[model samples]
Target chain A: MKRIFTPAFLLLTAQSFAQDIKPEMADSFRSSGKIYVVVCVAAIVLTGLLVYLITIDRKVSKLERDLKSLDKTSN
Target chain B: MNIKKNWWKAITCVLLFYTVIEGFLGAVPARDILNETIRNLYFHVPMWFGMMTLLFISVIYGIKHLHNGAMRSDLIAREAAHTGVIMGVLGLITGSLWARYTWGTWWTQDTKLNGAAITMLIYFAYFILRGSVEDEQKRARLSAVYSIFAFVMMIVFVMILPRMEDSLHPGNGGNPAFSKYDLDSKMRLVFYPAVLGWVLLGVWIMSVRIRIASISEALLNHSDTHPTS
Candidate 1:
């Protein structure tokens, strides 16, 4: 499938590459685009883990309730 | 109606607002040698400071929890460790970015960088250690001990590593700490608040997470006592 690159994606990519950083020395601060991808993915994964932890609290309560009801019925 | 509980949230919001404003202002103007790169110091150094602050608090809580078996202190310790990890991640990211611009590499085996990386790895193991144990009391006890160990290791790594080896980083190998020549009065103006604001923000985030954990714990306990079925 031929995927078209939309203007939005292009803008986002451009913005990420863009920086106002000036080097302390004469060296270029340019990083490989791949490194940026890796770091961004890591940040996203960490955020997702936090979201998952937040949601899991609900299921934990539900399980506890089920256990209590089972005990009640047995007794 | 609930005013006292909201203080931390209010503080969080204010600190975040200040971070953004200070960060932006850090960008607007600067002299030579610093220029835009100085802005990275505002974010990077503050994160390191916050990470250390959280870890130190965690160690204190750990000591209290172990000595007295106070669940609240244990909870505080766990939350502080989690917040420390988050700040550690931020520091690494910002430092790596700063390095990419200044050193032309995403990473180098310099003394400070190595020390920072090792400290990060040690905290990553903190979570692993927690997960390996299942008994609530045992997990808390073991993690508390380990947290103190990790905190000490962190300090040693930061303080001792740079001195033992030479590095391109500013303050290493006989280089004077807090050199006014490297860090001028203008930089200091932004630097101090940057550290304080970020440390407060880290604490605020940890407090929110801890409250959520406590509420969730209560909800679980309630379900155990009263079943819906």
Candidate 2:
């Protein structure tokens, strides 16, 4: 009887401890569906930056073309 | 830009858009201390990957310059290194922000952190060494040799040393990398593409810098030959 009681008591305590301690996460924020707002903001910023980079790339290509023409005329 | 030639830039745009959206919406393994900030893995880790790729390109150009004695190779090497430094700075800042929320401090004496700092300083010295040389040929020769040496040192500090000792950063010291256990299959779907996208972005910036440098050099030569214009 004593041996059985000791093991049972330990198991009960362990189960309670496991249930009491859980890692914290932003489940509430996610459940509310506001994560889409964050995602959209990030996407917009990235798109804006990429557009600027494309313009710079086009300008460089124009410069290269002009230089090639100048070389042909000079030669 | 030609569609065939510039397809990779379009891919970059698509991959990044996917990353930003999927990264936030995707499910992650629940773990203590990390929580929501575990999402940073998608953004922060990619910066280091991009930096390493740019620096590796720099080393390749350095070797090419030595082999062919081409100033064009030297220009590429310099621009690659510049872009690499920019990526590294971004990596450091993002890592610090992640650490502050997760590690409870803005800075710590972690092995990987210090290794990254030392590597940055070594590259900084490489730049300073280049600036001090007056002769272009001599400067190119000296810096090419130094770039090779610096790349080796970077591999040592950022990769090898961190693994040999105890480090707070994962994948170092005996700690398993995030991929081994923490990064589930769902997270990997975003992570790999994020690495590729960020690395491609670094290459794009480096290429732009190289083009600008070449244009300026050509303009300078044109002015020298025809002062009337």
How far off is residue A26 in model 2, in Å?
A: 1.5
Residues A1-75, model 1: lDDT tens digits:
002323333444455446575333212222222323433564465456445543554455465566557657745
**Could you list the iRMS of every candidate?**
8.3, 1.1
- Tens-digit lDDT track of model 1 for B2-105: 35854654454454455555443322333354545756666788898899999998999999999999888888888898999899988989888888876788
TM for candidate 1 is: 0.69
lDDT of 1 at A33: 28
Candidate 2 lDDT tens digits, B1-229: 7999999999999999988988987767767898878889889999999989999999999999999999999999999999999999999999999999989988899889999998899999989999999999899999999999999999999999999998889899887677663458888998999889988999998999999999999998998998887
Off by over 4 Å in 1: A1-75, B1-19, B26-34, B176-178, B181-183
Highest lDDT: give the candidate number.
2
For each candidate, the alpha-carbon lDDT, in order, equals 0.70, 0.88
- The C-alpha stretches of model 2 lying farther than 4 A from their native spots are A1-21, B181-183
